[model samples]
Target: MLRRFPTPLLVALCALTLTLVGTAPVSAAPTSAAPSNQARQLNQTILYYDSSRAAEYSSAVSSAVDVWNASVGNVRLEPAASGQHAEIRIITDDGWPRAHLGPVRPGGQVTVWMGRQGTAEGYDAVRIAAHELGHSLGLPDTKSGPCSSLMSGSTGGVNCTNAAPNASERSRVEANYGRGPAGESAADGRLLVDRR
Candidate 1:
Protein backbone atom coordinates (compact mmCIF):
# COMPACT_ATOMS: atom_id res chain seq x y z
CA MET A 1 0.00 0.00 0.00
CA LEU A 2 2.96 2.35 0.66
CA ARG A 3 4.45 3.36 -2.69
CA ARG A 4 6.82 6.26 -3.31
CA PHE A 5 9.86 6.32 -5.58
CA PRO A 6 12.31 9.17 -6.10
CA THR A 7 12.20 11.04 -9.37
CA PRO A 8 14.33 9.54 -12.19
CA LEU A 9 14.28 5.98 -10.89
CA LEU A 10 15.47 2.89 -12.77
CA VAL A 11 13.82 2.14 -16.07
CA ALA A 12 13.32 -1.60 -15.79
CA LEU A 13 11.01 -3.47 -18.13
CA CYS A 14 9.88 -6.24 -15.81
CA ALA A 15 9.62 -6.03 -12.01
CA LEU A 16 7.93 -8.37 -9.54
CA THR A 17 6.19 -7.59 -6.28
CA LEU A 18 5.89 -9.65 -3.07
CA THR A 19 2.96 -8.89 -0.82
CA LEU A 20 2.02 -10.50 2.52
CA VAL A 21 -1.54 -11.43 3.30
CA GLY A 22 -1.99 -12.15 7.01
CA THR A 23 -4.25 -11.40 9.95
CA ALA A 24 -3.51 -8.95 12.76
CA PRO A 25 -1.34 -10.29 15.55
CA VAL A 26 -3.11 -11.49 18.67
CA SER A 27 -1.22 -9.05 20.88
CA ALA A 28 -1.67 -5.75 19.12
CA ALA A 29 0.18 -2.72 20.43
CA PRO A 30 -1.53 -0.27 22.79
CA THR A 31 -3.58 2.26 20.83
CA SER A 32 -1.66 5.23 22.20
CA ALA A 33 1.62 4.37 20.35
CA ALA A 34 0.91 2.52 17.16
CA PRO A 35 -0.22 3.05 13.63
CA SER A 36 -4.01 2.77 13.94
CA ASN A 37 -4.22 0.29 11.05
CA GLN A 38 -1.84 -2.69 10.86
CA ALA A 39 -1.06 -4.67 7.75
CA ARG A 40 0.38 -8.09 6.94
CA GLN A 41 3.53 -7.43 4.93
CA LEU A 42 6.70 -9.28 3.86
CA ASN A 43 10.26 -8.12 3.09
CA GLN A 44 11.87 -8.88 -0.27
CA THR A 45 15.47 -8.41 -1.51
CA ILE A 46 15.97 -8.06 -5.24
CA LEU A 47 19.23 -7.95 -7.24
CA TYR A 48 19.06 -7.39 -10.97
CA TYR A 49 22.01 -8.60 -13.01
CA ASP A 50 23.06 -9.24 -16.56
CA SER A 51 22.91 -12.82 -17.78
CA SER A 52 26.71 -12.87 -17.97
CA ARG A 53 27.07 -11.60 -14.43
CA ALA A 54 24.62 -14.11 -13.03
CA ALA A 55 27.40 -16.37 -11.77
CA GLU A 56 28.64 -13.94 -9.14
CA TYR A 57 25.40 -12.07 -8.45
CA SER A 58 24.31 -14.73 -5.98
CA SER A 59 27.34 -14.15 -3.79
CA ALA A 60 26.07 -10.64 -3.27
CA VAL A 61 22.56 -11.83 -2.47
CA SER A 62 23.83 -14.35 0.10
CA SER A 63 26.07 -11.75 1.68
CA ALA A 64 23.12 -9.41 1.95
CA VAL A 65 20.65 -12.08 3.16
CA ASP A 66 23.07 -13.18 5.86
CA VAL A 67 23.11 -9.68 7.25
CA TRP A 68 19.33 -9.54 7.29
CA ASN A 69 18.99 -12.93 8.99
CA ALA A 70 21.43 -11.98 11.73
CA SER A 71 19.96 -8.57 12.56
CA VAL A 72 16.46 -8.22 11.13
CA GLY A 73 13.75 -10.75 11.97
CA ASN A 74 13.91 -14.34 10.66
CA VAL A 75 13.02 -14.03 6.99
CA ARG A 76 14.70 -16.33 4.45
CA LEU A 77 15.07 -16.00 0.71
CA GLU A 78 12.51 -18.28 -0.89
CA PRO A 79 14.10 -20.89 -3.15
CA ALA A 80 14.11 -20.53 -6.93
CA ALA A 81 10.89 -21.56 -8.62
CA SER A 82 10.22 -25.23 -9.43
CA GLY A 83 6.81 -24.78 -10.99
CA GLN A 84 4.84 -24.29 -7.79
CA HIS A 85 3.22 -21.26 -6.17
CA ALA A 86 6.30 -19.42 -4.96
CA GLU A 87 6.03 -16.34 -2.78
CA ILE A 88 9.48 -15.19 -3.97
CA ARG A 89 10.46 -15.69 -7.60
CA ILE A 90 12.84 -14.58 -10.36
CA ILE A 91 11.78 -14.08 -13.91
CA THR A 92 13.59 -13.20 -17.15
CA ASP A 93 11.72 -10.00 -17.73
CA ASP A 94 13.28 -8.26 -20.76
CA GLY A 95 13.48 -5.11 -18.67
CA TRP A 96 11.94 -4.67 -15.23
CA PRO A 97 11.46 -1.23 -13.81
CA ARG A 98 14.44 0.01 -11.78
CA ALA A 99 12.45 2.35 -9.57
CA HIS A 100 10.87 -0.73 -7.93
CA LEU A 101 12.32 -1.00 -4.43
CA GLY A 102 10.67 -0.97 -1.02
CA PRO A 103 8.87 -2.94 1.71
CA VAL A 104 7.26 -6.27 1.12
CA ARG A 105 5.37 -9.05 2.92
CA PRO A 106 8.33 -10.17 5.15
CA GLY A 107 8.66 -13.49 3.30
CA GLY A 108 7.49 -12.37 -0.09
CA GLN A 109 9.37 -12.54 -3.41
CA VAL A 110 11.24 -9.89 -5.46
CA THR A 111 12.49 -10.19 -9.01
CA VAL A 112 16.07 -8.92 -9.21
CA TRP A 113 16.73 -8.14 -12.83
CA MET A 114 19.67 -10.30 -13.81
CA GLY A 115 20.05 -8.09 -16.81
CA ARG A 116 21.56 -5.17 -14.95
CA GLN A 117 24.41 -6.70 -12.97
CA GLY A 118 27.48 -5.01 -14.43
CA THR A 119 26.06 -1.54 -13.87
CA ALA A 120 25.99 -2.44 -10.17
CA GLU A 121 29.70 -3.21 -9.81
CA GLY A 122 30.94 0.36 -9.29
CA TYR A 123 27.86 1.19 -7.27
CA ASP A 124 25.14 -0.74 -5.40
CA ALA A 125 26.74 -2.92 -2.76
CA VAL A 126 25.57 -4.84 0.30
CA ARG A 127 24.81 -1.56 2.03
CA ILE A 128 22.44 -0.36 -0.67
CA ALA A 129 20.65 -3.69 -0.54
CA ALA A 130 20.46 -3.52 3.23
CA HIS A 131 19.18 0.03 3.28
CA GLU A 132 16.48 -0.86 0.77
CA LEU A 133 15.53 -3.79 2.95
CA GLY A 134 15.37 -1.40 5.88
CA HIS A 135 12.64 0.35 3.98
CA SER A 136 10.89 -2.99 3.77
CA LEU A 137 11.29 -3.12 7.53
CA GLY A 138 9.16 0.04 7.51
CA LEU A 139 11.91 2.68 7.57
CA PRO A 140 11.88 5.83 5.46
CA ASP A 141 14.62 7.75 3.63
CA THR A 142 16.55 10.76 4.96
CA LYS A 143 17.23 12.23 1.48
CA SER A 144 20.74 13.00 2.65
CA GLY A 145 23.72 11.15 4.13
CA PRO A 146 27.52 10.94 4.80
CA CYS A 147 27.84 8.93 1.55
CA SER A 148 28.39 5.73 3.57
CA SER A 149 25.06 6.30 5.27
CA LEU A 150 22.53 3.96 3.67
CA MET A 151 19.67 6.42 4.05
CA SER A 152 21.36 8.89 1.71
CA GLY A 153 19.75 9.34 -1.68
CA SER A 154 23.10 9.25 -3.48
CA THR A 155 23.21 5.97 -5.43
CA GLY A 156 26.08 3.63 -6.40
CA GLY A 157 29.82 3.86 -5.48
CA VAL A 158 28.53 4.60 -2.02
CA ASN A 159 29.30 1.40 -0.24
CA CYS A 160 28.28 3.24 2.93
CA THR A 161 25.56 1.17 4.59
CA ASN A 162 24.14 0.86 8.10
CA ALA A 163 21.08 -1.39 8.23
CA ALA A 164 20.54 -0.88 11.96
CA PRO A 165 17.50 1.29 11.45
CA ASN A 166 18.06 4.74 12.96
CA ALA A 167 15.82 6.06 15.71
CA SER A 168 13.68 7.98 13.28
CA GLU A 169 13.42 5.01 10.91
CA ARG A 170 12.38 2.63 13.68
CA SER A 171 10.00 5.00 15.38
CA ARG A 172 8.25 6.08 12.19
CA VAL A 173 7.19 2.61 11.00
CA GLU A 174 6.60 0.95 14.37
CA ALA A 175 4.49 4.01 15.04
CA ASN A 176 2.14 2.57 12.45
CA TYR A 177 2.97 -1.11 11.96
CA GLY A 178 3.60 -3.03 15.19
CA ARG A 179 6.97 -4.54 16.19
CA GLY A 180 8.32 -7.14 13.72
CA PRO A 181 5.42 -9.51 13.25
CA ALA A 182 6.27 -13.20 13.15
CA GLY A 183 8.94 -13.34 10.42
CA GLU A 184 7.76 -16.85 9.63
CA SER A 185 5.96 -16.54 6.29
CA ALA A 186 6.01 -17.83 2.68
CA ALA A 187 6.94 -16.21 -0.65
CA ASP A 188 6.56 -17.53 -4.17
CA GLY A 189 9.67 -16.15 -5.86
CA ARG A 190 12.65 -17.74 -7.56
CA LEU A 191 15.83 -16.45 -6.04
CA LEU A 192 18.40 -16.04 -8.82
CA VAL A 193 20.82 -17.82 -6.56
CA ASP A 194 23.34 -20.56 -7.42
CA ARG A 195 22.77 -20.53 -11.14
CA ARG A 196 25.80 -21.07 -13.34
Candidate 2:
Protein backbone atom coordinates (compact mmCIF):
# COMPACT_ATOMS: atom_id res chain seq x y z
CA MET A 1 0.00 0.00 0.00
CA LEU A 2 1.12 3.49 -0.74
CA ARG A 3 0.06 6.62 1.14
CA ARG A 4 1.15 10.24 0.74
CA PHE A 5 0.83 13.34 2.91
CA PRO A 6 -1.28 15.99 1.25
CA THR A 7 0.96 18.59 -0.48
CA PRO A 8 -0.14 21.42 1.89
CA LEU A 9 0.32 19.35 5.08
CA LEU A 10 3.77 18.17 4.04
CA VAL A 11 4.78 21.70 3.18
CA ALA A 12 3.54 22.96 6.56
CA LEU A 13 5.48 20.33 8.52
CA CYS A 14 8.67 21.08 6.58
CA ALA A 15 8.21 24.79 7.21
CA LEU A 16 7.74 24.22 10.93
CA THR A 17 10.86 22.06 11.20
CA LEU A 18 12.97 24.66 9.36
CA THR A 19 11.64 27.44 11.53
CA LEU A 20 12.38 25.59 14.76
CA VAL A 21 15.84 24.59 13.62
CA GLY A 22 16.70 28.07 12.46
CA THR A 23 15.58 29.72 15.67
CA ALA A 24 17.41 27.30 17.96
CA PRO A 25 18.99 28.93 21.00
CA VAL A 26 22.62 29.88 20.59
CA SER A 27 23.55 28.42 23.98
CA ALA A 28 22.74 24.95 22.69
CA ALA A 29 25.86 25.05 20.55
CA PRO A 30 29.37 25.00 22.08
CA THR A 31 31.61 27.71 20.71
CA SER A 32 35.34 27.45 20.93
CA ALA A 33 35.76 31.23 20.81
CA ALA A 34 33.82 32.04 23.95
CA PRO A 35 35.71 33.01 27.09
CA SER A 36 34.37 32.11 30.52
CA ASN A 37 34.08 34.29 33.64
CA GLN A 38 36.53 32.06 35.45
CA ALA A 39 39.00 32.18 32.59
CA ARG A 40 39.35 35.92 33.25
CA GLN A 41 40.65 35.11 36.73
CA LEU A 42 43.82 33.67 35.26
CA ASN A 43 45.71 36.94 35.71
CA GLN A 44 47.22 36.44 39.15
CA THR A 45 48.24 39.54 41.07
CA ILE A 46 51.18 38.17 43.00
CA LEU A 47 52.20 39.69 46.34
CA TYR A 48 55.05 38.36 48.38
CA TYR A 49 56.28 38.88 51.92
CA ASP A 50 59.28 37.88 53.95
CA SER A 51 57.42 37.53 57.24
CA SER A 52 60.75 36.64 58.85
CA ARG A 53 60.16 38.39 62.13
CA ALA A 54 56.46 37.75 61.98
CA ALA A 55 56.99 33.98 61.95
CA GLU A 56 54.48 33.61 64.77
CA TYR A 57 51.83 35.11 62.51
CA SER A 58 52.66 32.94 59.50
CA SER A 59 49.50 30.90 59.86
CA ALA A 60 47.52 34.09 60.19
CA VAL A 61 48.95 35.46 56.94
CA SER A 62 48.30 32.23 55.11
CA SER A 63 44.77 32.15 56.46
CA ALA A 64 44.26 35.71 55.33
CA VAL A 65 45.41 34.81 51.83
CA ASP A 66 43.02 31.92 51.82
CA VAL A 67 40.16 34.16 52.93
CA TRP A 68 40.79 36.70 50.16
CA ASN A 69 41.36 33.96 47.60
CA ALA A 70 38.02 32.41 48.44
CA SER A 71 36.20 35.73 48.53
CA VAL A 72 37.33 37.28 45.24
CA GLY A 73 37.56 35.93 41.70
CA ASN A 74 40.59 37.96 40.59
CA VAL A 75 44.06 38.52 42.06
CA ARG A 76 45.79 35.91 44.15
CA LEU A 77 48.42 36.34 46.84
CA GLU A 78 51.37 34.04 46.56
CA PRO A 79 54.53 33.65 48.56
CA ALA A 80 57.35 35.19 46.55
CA ALA A 81 60.22 33.12 45.23
CA SER A 82 63.36 33.26 47.31
CA GLY A 83 65.35 36.42 46.48
CA GLN A 84 62.62 37.55 44.12
CA HIS A 85 61.63 41.20 44.30
CA ALA A 86 58.62 41.46 46.54
CA GLU A 87 55.91 44.00 46.05
CA ILE A 88 54.76 43.72 49.63
CA ARG A 89 57.12 43.26 52.54
CA ILE A 90 55.84 42.07 55.91
CA ILE A 91 57.71 42.62 59.14
CA THR A 92 56.88 42.86 62.83
CA ASP A 93 56.67 45.87 65.09
CA ASP A 94 55.82 46.59 68.71
CA GLY A 95 52.79 48.69 67.78
CA TRP A 96 49.49 47.74 66.16
CA PRO A 97 49.35 45.84 62.88
CA ARG A 98 49.25 47.99 59.75
CA ALA A 99 49.85 47.93 55.98
CA HIS A 100 50.38 50.34 53.14
CA LEU A 101 47.45 50.68 50.78
CA GLY A 102 48.99 49.78 47.49
CA PRO A 103 48.78 48.39 44.03
CA VAL A 104 52.51 48.31 44.49
CA ARG A 105 54.22 47.34 41.28
CA PRO A 106 57.49 45.56 40.73
CA GLY A 107 60.60 47.61 41.67
CA GLY A 108 58.34 49.30 44.21
CA GLN A 109 57.52 48.18 47.73
CA VAL A 110 54.93 48.27 50.49
CA THR A 111 55.29 47.23 54.08
CA VAL A 112 52.87 45.31 56.27
CA TRP A 113 54.00 45.53 59.85
CA MET A 114 52.44 42.72 61.86
CA GLY A 115 52.52 44.44 65.19
CA ARG A 116 51.72 42.75 68.50
CA GLN A 117 49.53 45.52 69.86
CA GLY A 118 46.37 44.29 68.14
CA THR A 119 46.80 40.69 69.22
CA ALA A 120 47.56 41.87 72.74
CA GLU A 121 44.16 43.53 72.71
CA GLY A 122 42.53 40.17 71.90
CA TYR A 123 41.95 40.69 68.18
CA ASP A 124 42.16 37.50 66.14
CA ALA A 125 45.49 37.11 64.35
CA VAL A 126 43.82 35.82 61.21
CA ARG A 127 41.43 38.77 61.17
CA ILE A 128 44.36 41.12 61.65
CA ALA A 129 46.13 39.50 58.71
CA ALA A 130 43.12 39.81 56.44
CA HIS A 131 42.45 43.38 57.54
CA GLU A 132 46.01 44.54 56.86
CA LEU A 133 46.00 42.72 53.54
CA GLY A 134 42.72 44.37 52.72
CA HIS A 135 44.52 47.70 52.97
CA SER A 136 47.21 46.39 50.66
CA LEU A 137 44.50 45.54 48.15
CA GLY A 138 43.10 49.09 48.14
CA LEU A 139 40.33 48.87 50.71
CA PRO A 140 40.08 51.60 53.32
CA ASP A 141 39.22 50.72 56.88
CA THR A 142 35.47 50.74 57.38
CA LYS A 143 35.93 50.76 61.18
CA SER A 144 32.19 51.23 61.67
CA GLY A 145 30.89 47.81 60.72
CA PRO A 146 30.33 44.81 62.95
CA CYS A 147 32.64 41.86 63.54
CA SER A 148 31.15 40.33 60.41
CA SER A 149 33.04 42.93 58.37
CA LEU A 150 36.76 42.35 57.97
CA MET A 151 37.45 45.96 56.99
CA SER A 152 35.96 47.20 60.20
CA GLY A 153 39.38 46.51 61.71
CA SER A 154 39.67 47.08 65.44
CA THR A 155 36.18 48.40 65.84
CA GLY A 156 35.06 44.77 65.67
CA GLY A 157 36.57 44.45 69.18
CA VAL A 158 38.74 41.90 70.92
CA ASN A 159 36.42 38.95 70.24
CA CYS A 160 36.15 39.76 66.53
CA THR A 161 38.06 36.90 64.98
CA ASN A 162 35.99 36.96 61.82
CA ALA A 163 38.58 37.06 59.08
CA ALA A 164 36.13 37.23 56.20
CA PRO A 165 35.29 40.49 54.48
CA ASN A 166 31.64 41.43 54.29
CA ALA A 167 29.65 41.31 51.03
CA SER A 168 30.49 44.88 50.02
CA GLU A 169 34.12 44.28 50.89
CA ARG A 170 34.24 41.21 48.67
CA SER A 171 32.36 42.92 45.88
CA ARG A 172 34.75 45.86 45.87
CA VAL A 173 37.75 43.61 45.45
CA GLU A 174 36.05 41.64 42.68
CA ALA A 175 35.00 44.81 40.93
CA ASN A 176 38.50 46.22 41.20
CA TYR A 177 40.31 43.14 39.92
CA GLY A 178 37.56 41.18 38.15
CA ARG A 179 37.86 42.99 34.86
CA GLY A 180 41.58 42.22 34.60
CA PRO A 181 45.00 43.46 35.73
CA ALA A 182 44.33 46.86 34.22
CA GLY A 183 42.97 48.60 37.31
CA GLU A 184 46.06 47.90 39.40
CA SER A 185 48.00 50.74 37.81
CA ALA A 186 47.14 53.26 40.49
CA ALA A 187 50.15 54.83 42.19
CA ASP A 188 51.02 53.43 45.58
CA GLY A 189 51.11 55.04 49.08
CA ARG A 190 47.60 55.96 50.14
CA LEU A 191 46.75 55.54 53.85
CA LEU A 192 47.49 53.24 56.75
CA VAL A 193 45.09 51.86 59.35
CA ASP A 194 46.68 50.44 62.46
CA ARG A 195 44.31 47.76 63.75
CA ARG A 196 43.95 49.51 67.07
Candidate 3:
Protein backbone atom coordinates (compact mmCIF):
# COMPACT_ATOMS: atom_id res chain seq x y z
CA MET A 1 0.00 0.00 0.00
CA LEU A 2 2.33 2.74 -1.24
CA ARG A 3 1.67 5.59 -3.60
CA ARG A 4 4.07 4.89 -6.41
CA PHE A 5 5.92 8.06 -7.35
CA PRO A 6 6.49 9.04 -10.94
CA THR A 7 9.54 8.03 -12.91
CA PRO A 8 12.77 8.39 -11.00
CA LEU A 9 14.26 11.61 -12.33
CA LEU A 10 17.79 10.98 -13.60
CA VAL A 11 19.08 13.45 -11.02
CA ALA A 12 22.72 14.42 -10.60
CA LEU A 13 22.71 16.93 -7.72
CA CYS A 14 19.60 15.81 -5.89
CA ALA A 15 20.45 12.13 -6.31
CA LEU A 16 16.99 11.93 -7.95
CA THR A 17 14.53 13.87 -10.10
CA LEU A 18 10.91 13.99 -11.36
CA THR A 19 10.28 15.26 -14.87
CA LEU A 20 7.27 15.46 -17.22
CA VAL A 21 8.02 15.90 -20.89
CA GLY A 22 6.03 17.84 -23.48
CA THR A 23 6.60 20.67 -25.94
CA ALA A 24 4.47 23.10 -24.01
CA PRO A 25 5.88 26.56 -23.49
CA VAL A 26 7.61 27.04 -20.17
CA SER A 27 5.34 28.67 -17.60
CA ALA A 28 6.27 31.52 -15.30
CA ALA A 29 4.97 31.72 -11.77
CA PRO A 30 2.23 34.32 -11.56
CA THR A 31 3.33 37.40 -9.62
CA SER A 32 0.36 37.91 -7.42
CA ALA A 33 -0.41 37.93 -3.67
CA ALA A 34 3.12 37.25 -2.40
CA PRO A 35 5.33 39.10 0.06
CA SER A 36 8.33 41.05 -1.28
CA ASN A 37 10.97 38.85 0.35
CA GLN A 38 9.63 35.56 -1.06
CA ALA A 39 10.17 33.94 2.33
CA ARG A 40 6.75 32.84 3.42
CA GLN A 41 5.36 29.36 3.96
CA LEU A 42 1.66 29.94 4.46
CA ASN A 43 -0.33 27.48 6.52
CA GLN A 44 -2.63 26.38 3.73
CA THR A 45 -4.44 23.10 2.94
CA ILE A 46 -4.11 20.44 0.20
CA LEU A 47 -6.27 17.64 -1.31
CA TYR A 48 -5.46 14.28 -2.89
CA TYR A 49 -6.81 10.79 -3.43
CA ASP A 50 -6.46 8.29 -0.62
CA SER A 51 -7.52 5.16 -2.42
CA SER A 52 -6.71 3.05 -5.46
CA ARG A 53 -3.60 4.25 -7.25
CA ALA A 54 -3.51 7.37 -5.15
CA ALA A 55 -4.92 6.01 -1.93
CA GLU A 56 -2.90 2.86 -2.22
CA TYR A 57 0.23 4.98 -2.10
CA SER A 58 0.20 8.26 -0.13
CA SER A 59 3.52 7.80 1.65
CA ALA A 60 5.50 9.18 -1.29
CA VAL A 61 3.25 12.21 -1.62
CA SER A 62 3.35 12.79 2.10
CA SER A 63 7.14 12.63 2.12
CA ALA A 64 7.51 15.44 -0.43
CA VAL A 65 5.05 17.71 1.36
CA ASP A 66 6.62 16.98 4.70
CA VAL A 67 9.88 18.38 3.32
CA TRP A 68 8.24 21.63 2.26
CA ASN A 69 6.32 21.98 5.49
CA ALA A 70 9.41 21.50 7.61
CA SER A 71 11.96 23.49 5.58
CA VAL A 72 9.95 26.66 5.01
CA GLY A 73 8.30 28.57 7.85
CA ASN A 74 5.06 29.20 5.98
CA VAL A 75 3.42 26.36 4.13
CA ARG A 76 1.26 23.74 5.87
CA LEU A 77 -1.42 21.25 4.82
CA GLU A 78 -4.53 19.28 5.84
CA PRO A 79 -6.20 16.39 4.04
CA ALA A 80 -9.52 16.82 2.26
CA ALA A 81 -11.99 14.27 0.90
CA SER A 82 -10.66 12.11 -1.88
CA GLY A 83 -12.97 13.49 -4.63
CA GLN A 84 -13.93 16.74 -2.94
CA HIS A 85 -12.46 19.58 -0.88
CA ALA A 86 -9.30 19.36 -2.98
CA GLU A 87 -8.91 19.38 -6.76
CA ILE A 88 -6.90 16.17 -7.34
CA ARG A 89 -7.54 14.07 -10.42
CA ILE A 90 -5.58 11.50 -12.48
CA ILE A 91 -4.75 11.33 -16.24
CA THR A 92 -4.68 7.48 -16.46
CA ASP A 93 -2.36 8.12 -19.36
CA ASP A 94 1.37 7.82 -18.92
CA GLY A 95 1.86 11.57 -18.73
CA TRP A 96 -0.43 14.50 -18.01
CA PRO A 97 -1.55 16.13 -21.23
CA ARG A 98 -0.35 19.70 -21.69
CA ALA A 99 -3.90 20.94 -21.32
CA HIS A 100 -4.42 19.04 -18.03
CA LEU A 101 -1.08 20.08 -16.49
CA GLY A 102 -0.86 23.70 -15.35
CA PRO A 103 -0.21 25.97 -12.41
CA VAL A 104 -1.81 25.20 -9.05
CA ARG A 105 -3.48 27.56 -6.59
CA PRO A 106 -1.50 28.90 -3.68
CA GLY A 107 -3.04 27.69 -0.39
CA GLY A 108 -5.94 26.61 -2.51
CA GLN A 109 -6.51 23.15 -3.99
CA VAL A 110 -4.63 20.06 -5.30
CA THR A 111 -5.72 17.21 -7.53
CA VAL A 112 -4.21 14.05 -9.10
CA TRP A 113 -5.96 12.22 -11.89
CA MET A 114 -5.19 8.48 -11.86
CA GLY A 115 -5.35 8.05 -15.57
CA ARG A 116 -3.08 5.02 -15.85
CA GLN A 117 -1.77 3.08 -12.92
CA GLY A 118 1.13 0.87 -14.06
CA THR A 119 3.33 0.66 -17.14
CA ALA A 120 5.76 3.34 -18.33
CA GLU A 121 3.03 5.63 -19.67
CA GLY A 122 1.22 5.37 -16.37
CA TYR A 123 3.14 7.95 -14.37
CA ASP A 124 4.10 6.90 -10.88
CA ALA A 125 1.04 8.10 -8.97
CA VAL A 126 3.06 9.10 -5.91
CA ARG A 127 5.66 11.05 -7.89
CA ILE A 128 3.01 12.81 -9.93
CA ALA A 129 1.14 13.55 -6.74
CA ALA A 130 4.25 14.94 -5.09
CA HIS A 131 5.24 17.05 -8.12
CA GLU A 132 1.72 18.39 -8.63
CA LEU A 133 1.47 19.40 -5.01
CA GLY A 134 4.72 21.29 -5.41
CA HIS A 135 3.01 23.35 -8.13
CA SER A 136 0.02 24.09 -5.93
CA LEU A 137 2.46 25.24 -3.27
CA GLY A 138 4.06 27.63 -5.81
CA LEU A 139 7.11 25.71 -7.05
CA PRO A 140 7.95 25.93 -10.75
CA ASP A 141 10.20 23.90 -13.01
CA THR A 142 13.61 25.45 -13.66
CA LYS A 143 14.67 22.69 -16.03
CA SER A 144 17.92 23.22 -14.12
CA GLY A 145 19.82 20.18 -15.36
CA PRO A 146 18.69 17.78 -18.03
CA CYS A 147 17.61 15.77 -14.94
CA SER A 148 18.16 15.43 -11.15
CA SER A 149 15.27 17.55 -9.76
CA LEU A 150 11.60 16.77 -9.26
CA MET A 151 10.72 20.11 -10.80
CA SER A 152 12.27 19.20 -14.11
CA GLY A 153 10.11 19.62 -17.26
CA SER A 154 9.92 15.88 -17.82
CA THR A 155 7.71 13.76 -15.54
CA GLY A 156 10.70 11.70 -14.52
CA GLY A 157 10.78 9.58 -11.38
CA VAL A 158 11.18 11.65 -8.24
CA ASN A 159 13.62 10.99 -5.46
CA CYS A 160 11.47 12.00 -2.51
CA THR A 161 14.39 12.41 -0.13
CA ASN A 162 16.70 13.72 -2.83
CA ALA A 163 13.92 15.67 -4.57
CA ALA A 164 14.20 18.18 -1.76
CA PRO A 165 13.47 21.64 -3.07
CA ASN A 166 16.36 24.03 -3.65
CA ALA A 167 16.48 27.58 -2.32
CA SER A 168 14.75 29.18 -5.31
CA GLU A 169 12.16 26.42 -5.36
CA ARG A 170 11.56 26.82 -1.66
CA SER A 171 11.26 30.58 -2.06
CA ARG A 172 8.67 30.24 -4.79
CA VAL A 173 6.31 28.27 -2.54
CA GLU A 174 6.93 30.39 0.53
CA ALA A 175 6.35 33.53 -1.55
CA ASN A 176 2.94 32.19 -2.47
CA TYR A 177 2.09 31.36 1.11
CA GLY A 178 3.37 33.24 4.14
CA ARG A 179 5.70 30.84 5.96
CA GLY A 180 5.74 27.38 7.48
CA PRO A 181 6.47 26.34 11.07
CA ALA A 182 9.23 28.17 12.90
CA GLY A 183 11.86 25.40 13.08
CA GLU A 184 10.48 22.69 10.87
CA SER A 185 12.83 20.82 8.54
CA ALA A 186 12.51 18.09 5.90
CA ALA A 187 11.75 14.61 7.20
CA ASP A 188 12.05 11.17 5.60
CA GLY A 189 10.63 11.30 2.03
CA ARG A 190 9.72 8.35 -0.19
CA LEU A 191 6.95 7.00 -2.49
CA LEU A 192 6.25 3.72 -4.28
CA VAL A 193 3.78 3.66 -7.20
CA ASP A 194 1.97 0.66 -8.71
CA ARG A 195 -1.48 -0.42 -9.95
CA ARG A 196 -3.59 -3.00 -8.16
TM-score of each: 0.42, 0.76, 0.47
lDDT by residue (tens digit), candidate 2, 22-112? 8989775576545664466555555665665566898888888899888876667777777887777777778878888865554568888
Give candidates' CA RMSD values in order: 22.4, 6.6, 22.8
Which prediction has more favorable lDDT, 1 or 3? 3
* Candidate 1: Cα lDDT at 187: 29
lDDT for predicted candidate 2 compared with the true structure: 0.77
RMSD of candidate 1 to true structure, Å: 22.4
Question: How many angstroms is residue 109 displaced in model 3 relative to the true structure, after the best TM-score fit?
Answer: 3.4
Each prediction's whole-model lDDT (CA) = 0.39, 0.77, 0.45
lDDT by residue for model 3 (42-161), tens: 344343423334444456556655766665665465555645544434333453422123233332333444333332454444445555556555454445333345565343443222
- What shift in Å separates residue 76 of candidate 2 from its native position after superposition? 0.4
What tens digits encode model 1's per-residue C-alpha lDDT throughout 107-185? 3434344333322443444554445444444344565555544455333233544434455544443432334432222
**Which rank order by lDDT, best down to worst?**
2, 3, 1
Pairs of residues clashing in candidate 2? none
TM-score of 3: 0.47
